[model samples]
Structure formats: C-alpha cells, structure tokens
Target: MSGPGPARPRLLGCDFSSTPSRRKPIVLAWGRCEGNTVMLEALERFPTLSAWTGRLAQVPAWIGGFDFPFGLPREFVIAQGWPLDWAGCMATYTALGRAELRERFVAFCAARPVGGKFAHRAADRPAGSSPSMKWVNPPVAWMMHAGVPGLLAAGAWLPGQGGVVGAPRVALEAYPGLVARDLLGARSYKSDERAKQTPQRQAARVELLHRLGAGEGRLGLRLQAPDALGQVFVDDASGDALDAALCLMLAAWGEARAESEGPGFGLPARMDPLEGWIVGA
Candidate 1:
C-alpha cells in the first residue's frame, strides 16, 4: 500500500464477481489519498470469496468501496415478508440456499408484469444500476447473496448498516460504471472474449486513465501513478484494472466529502440501510 496521508484510512476499491474463480477473479485495488491525489499502489485478485474475506480480516484499517449491492430493495423485502431492518433482513435473506433463493426470486419476477419484473432499490435509478433482485443478466442478486455476508463476517463496519464510529475498516457501496460513464459516456471499455477485446476498447481504457490522472471528471480526485502502471491499466482487456481504479478514486472523493461535510462519506443522510446507497450517486 502507499504511505499513509492526512490521518485518513487507506482506500480500497473492489470489483466483485459472484462465484469468483481463477478465470474471473475478484479484483481489489488499494491505495492512499493525499490532498487531491488518489494514488493506486497495488492490485490484487482472489480466486474465491473465502480468500477475499480472509484477506480483509487481516487489514487493520481501510475505507473500501465495493462493487456489489449492499442490500435488497425495501419493497421486495416487505412484499416477501422479510425483516424490515438491515441486519435482520440480511440474516433472513442469507439463510436460504442459492437454489431455493433463486427459485423464489424467479417466481417473484414471473408474477410481475413485463418491464416491472424486478423490484428496484432507490439507488438503482439514480446510479443507473441493475435491480438488486435480478438473478440473471448480471446476477447481482447472487453477488449480494455471496458478498455481504463476507463483509459482516470479516467484522468490517458497513456505513448506514451497523458501522461503529472509528471502526477499523469501513465498507461502503460503490459503482465504477457511475464514474466511467461520467467521464467516457457509453464508450465500450472491456470485453471478456479475446476476439472482442479490440484496440478501440484498449484505447478507451488509455483515455480513461489519462483523464483520471489529469483530474478530469466527477470524482474530482486525480489518479497518481507511474507511466508503466498507467499502461497496466490499459493492457487488461477485461477492464477490471481500470474499473478498480475508478472505484478507488471514488473512495478518495468520499473521504474528501466526509472531511468537508459531516460523516457518511458522500452517502445521503436519508439513505436506507436495507437498500444501501451508492457512494457517489
């Protein structure tokens, strides 16, 4: 990690995958923020959720912005008769096996009319994110099912959920797409297929890094990195590296907001813990 600065905790940004594997690992970008600069010091990948959680348990202090849904929509929870509070809802939601959960979610969606099959969290519309209840397409529901429990198990403080003041490691919800779109609009930046990973996408990544380094875009924090490291962000066709960097910058922005505005780290004061807010939304 980079050297500490401003007495603030180190920053982390994670791009998560449900059912993480060696082929599509969960990527974590970690660094430090100094003044207006967010320096990305390292990138790590974990092949499994357990490995990621175990690594998190060892960190002494950090403020992380993870690319996963922190909670389900309140409407869905209420309709399903789940607990209303965040902790209780998570407990009730996580108890079921994935198969059972999928079955129930599928049924719920099937019963709804077209264009409204999935219920949405308040943050979804604002962040332009997928509905947390959708099991297919992105499988973000499963990501939530797999990811949040690990944060809880690792004893990381979840803002607006159950975080205590001065908690060693604070975890917040973040969306890299928000930052990416803010800067690059709808330009494609990544592809999982080798054939589809064209030079244009690589160029998009390069342009993104350049702009981010130059402190252009919504987060208002510059990315500080060596030239070679900037190349590293572009060479990966999966776009995981650049996405992680975007998330890291968002973390820095959140820290700045917390320092200026009160606590809550750029999240809205009225955010619902049951349906967590996106960090920069």
Candidate 2:
C-alpha cells in the first residue's frame, strides 16, 4: 500500500509505583498506534525511579501516558506559600522529604472539615482520580512526589504544565482508572493482595480486556496484543500490565489530538497550568 503508511510513533504507558521494588516494580507498556489500533509490543519493569528516569531520557521519541498526578491543587500551593507556577511549584514540592510533605498535608487536612479535607485540582473530578494531596489509601500524593520530578529531570515535555522546547518525549498525566471504569463500570478488576484477587475480579479483568480490544469507549481505539502478552495481562492479579496497556491507549489518543488540534495535547485551552488536566479526561 504505497510502501506502507508512515510509521507510528513509539508510545509508552506507565503503571508507576511510588516505592518500586523487585516484587512491585514500575511497569511500562511499550506499544505503537496504527490508525485506530494500539498494539502492545512489550512490558518493562524498573525497580527504582532512577532507573525509570534514565530509561525515559534515552528513548529517542515517545508520547507516554504516566499514571500519576503531574500537578497539585492551586489552593494547596497558595496555602502553603509555594510557588504559583508549575515549574517552581514542582521544584519546591519535590525538594521536601516525603515525611515533611506528609506533615504539611496532614496539617492542611486537619484544618478543614472532615468531608472536605483535601483540595482538588480541576482534572480530578472529570478524570475520577483521587485528590493529588492524599498521602494514604492509594498514596497518590507520594506518587506525584516520586514521579513528576523525574519527568522534569528526564526532560520530557509536559504538554499543559511546562514544556521543554524541542523535547522528543512527551509526558501526559494519565489515569488508567478512568479508562478502566469506562470498561469495567464500577466493577473491581484487580488487587495487590493475594487474598483479594478473587475469581470475580479475574472475570472482570477478562471482560475489560475483551471490551478494550473491541474499542468500546469514547477514545475509539482498539488494542491489539500478542496472545502471550494478552495472557500476561489477564493473569497478573496486580493489574499492573493491564493498567499500562490502558495508559498506552490514552497516550495514542493524546498523540492523535496533538496531530489534529496542535499543542496542549487536547487539554482545555483555559485549563489552569498549575493544575494540569488529565489528557483525554
């Protein structure tokens, strides 16, 4: 077909861990998009954030969907007297130790009402992601602390936040739960604990994979994985592989938006730069 169509850009979906170890490393799903199809090529694991950052810096070009909040709530920033802009805010936030960050967050929550303890960014509601300030439960606040600084260090361009001019790798804040909810619909599909990995969750994961391959959501991109890889996704009770695959699809969608809509990576034009919007939210 005319010497084959133009090659698709490499895509990455990260299922990040705030504290990665050999047993629960950050998982990266590598793939490429062809037209409306996103194909998974491989999954890579990094036991440390440094190793992951190094890998990101070496990739020649990619649009990665990273499963972590890229920015904190503007309210939180202002209240803490941190810098208002994305770059300064991230720099100031990352400079503090995890314990110091937790202490500040806990104090902030203690001052507020029980139900409204956490401040939220604009993207949280639409994306159905947890408040970026939460330190416990899912500990996404720690994830942001651990992840975004590395993205900056690696020189990846964050679309709405701050972009590095001429940067080859593009990083978007992605939440696989958004896509997973669309396919699974409040159904539980994964668990980190062995005791929680029930047959019901396993069946839910199978159904989610089936629906994703059939292109069942608003993104309208089908997923294609080798049989063995597909098996890996289904068999992993931790759901890290499946989450990474979902991120890949989101990254592909962001890439398509970049091509058609030009910069901002399909994020709202008026979105607060200090609180970056989740791509495809």
Candidate lDDT values, in order: 0.87, 0.91
- TM-scores vs. true structure, each candidate: 0.94, 0.96
Q: Write the per-residue lDDT of candidate 1 for residues 143-243, one digit (tens) a residue.
A: 98999899888888887887454587888888999998888999989988899999999998888887888899877888998776678788889998777
Q: List the residue pairs that clash in candidate 1.
A: none
Query: Candidate 1: minimum summed lDDT over ten consecutive residues — where?
Result: 159-168
Model 2 has an lDDT value of 0.91
Displacement of residue 281 (Cα, Å) in model 1 is 0.2
Q: What is the lDDT of candidate 1?
A: 0.87
- Give the RMSD in angstroms, all C-alphas superposed, for model 2: 2.1
